[model samples]
Target: MISYFNDYANLCFEKFGDRVKYWITFNNPWTHAKVWHSYNKTWRNKQQGMVGISLTSAWGEPVDLTSQKDIEAAERYVQFYLGWFANPIYSGDYPEVMKNYVGRKSAQQGLGMSRLPTFSVQEKSYIKGTSDFLGLSHFTTRYIIQKNYSALKGPSYHTDRDLVELVDPKWPDPGSKWLYSVPWGFRRLLNFIKTQYGNPLIYVTENGVSEKLQCIQLCDEWRIEYLKGYINEMLKDPLTTHMEMVTEIVVPTVFTLCILISAILLMFLLRKHN
Candidate 1:
């Protein structure tokens, strides 16, 4: 299955490398093999193109900062989400927590071998240090804590990480169950990326707020504030914030214009009344 994807990407590279300067290969060991070969061996030196994987994470704040279990669970949240993909590309294997927990669970289930696959030295070497940059997508934040569940509930990716996620009631939730506007989490996530994978070059690939599909939300007050707060946090460090340039500048400008106009109209009415 992996080889098939590799061949497909290679075909695209063979035909399109001259025109396409950047690429993002999908996940999996085979995915990296194809992506690295396509860029490093086949096209990068020739075309100077780049290849990376797009990854998404929600920042996990420990339920109790001082509690070791909560802190470990918070790290597990990252390991399960971003590290599930990033670790292999950057560090050459699955996270230690992932291996340990999965292996222990598999044993309890009376499996002959661990359900989690071990990487061969060759696979690890080939996969390690393969990515050119880290492409990240992050949203909101969650308070995390440790939980132990029965493997009888079934072996699944979600269950492998024994953790529970909670959110603060005070966070400004813009009606999406999954998204809460927690801007400060952005800076923490960026810093984590810097420290975790040896500070690879990072490009933020996606971020969004969910809203009911409306024909027109011209004022767009909710999203504007969300972006404003989030972008400000990102700027606190020298990291990135995402969106199209038009929306990035224009939305805020429009918002400021509306506030100014409303304020002026109010003053005009007050003076007339007086």
Candidate 2:
């Protein structure tokens, strides 16, 4: 699969290499190290483009500020989700909490080795600095609480974390049921990434909401507010200088183009009938 993707990426670099200066080899590759390494090795010298992966994760806030267990669970929540992928790329291995928790769980389940995979020293070195930048996609926050699952529950990704995710009822629910507007979470997540990964170059690849409504509302006040809050929160972080609100730009442009094409087709059909 790595070789196949490398071949496909090389084709892209050849065809659109001049115009496309940035290439994301994958979007949310839960495992991006090897593929990123392959692309960097094959094309860095040949192409004038930057290669990176897009990782989407929500901020995890502790359900209780005074509870150490809740704080640990919140940290674990982010580690299991974002760190599962980002750690390998930036730091050359998985989060220590992830390894310890999963390893201990694997043993309790009568497994000889960890459920989480390992990398050799050489593999670690190769994968360490493959990415030129980090592409982050964030939406909302989750309240985290510690929840220990029995080994009998089986070895799975969810159970391995031993955490429960919750959301406050007070948060604004614009349209998407799952995505609650928590702009403050965006700032927290950005700062966490900076601290976790030595402040690597970052690009905000995706951040927006979906409207669940019966009618099309062009004004979209909720979306505007969502963008403003998120963008403003991001600006508060000194580490973030540039961000690409992809959905904000792409969706509206596509919708407008579709409407224009439909109107043109309607005009042509009316003339033909006349």
RMSD of each: 9.6, 14.0
Q: Can you tell me which runs of candidate 2 are displaced by over 4 Å?
A: 34-42, 216-219, 237-274
Rate residue 19 of model 1 by lDDT: 94
Output the number of the TM-score-best candidate.
2
Model 2 Cα shift for residue 122 (angstroms): 1.6
For 220-258, candidate 1 gives per-residue lDDT tens digits of 677788888888887773433455544667688999999
lDDT of candidate model 1 versus the reference: 0.81
Clashing pairs in 1: none
lDDT of 2 by residue, 1-274 (tens): 7767777777877788778878776788855565556556766677757888888999999999999999999999999989988998888899999999999999999999998889899988977887888899899999999999988899898999999989899998658778999999999998899888998888999999886455665767778888999999987725433343445665678999999999999999999999
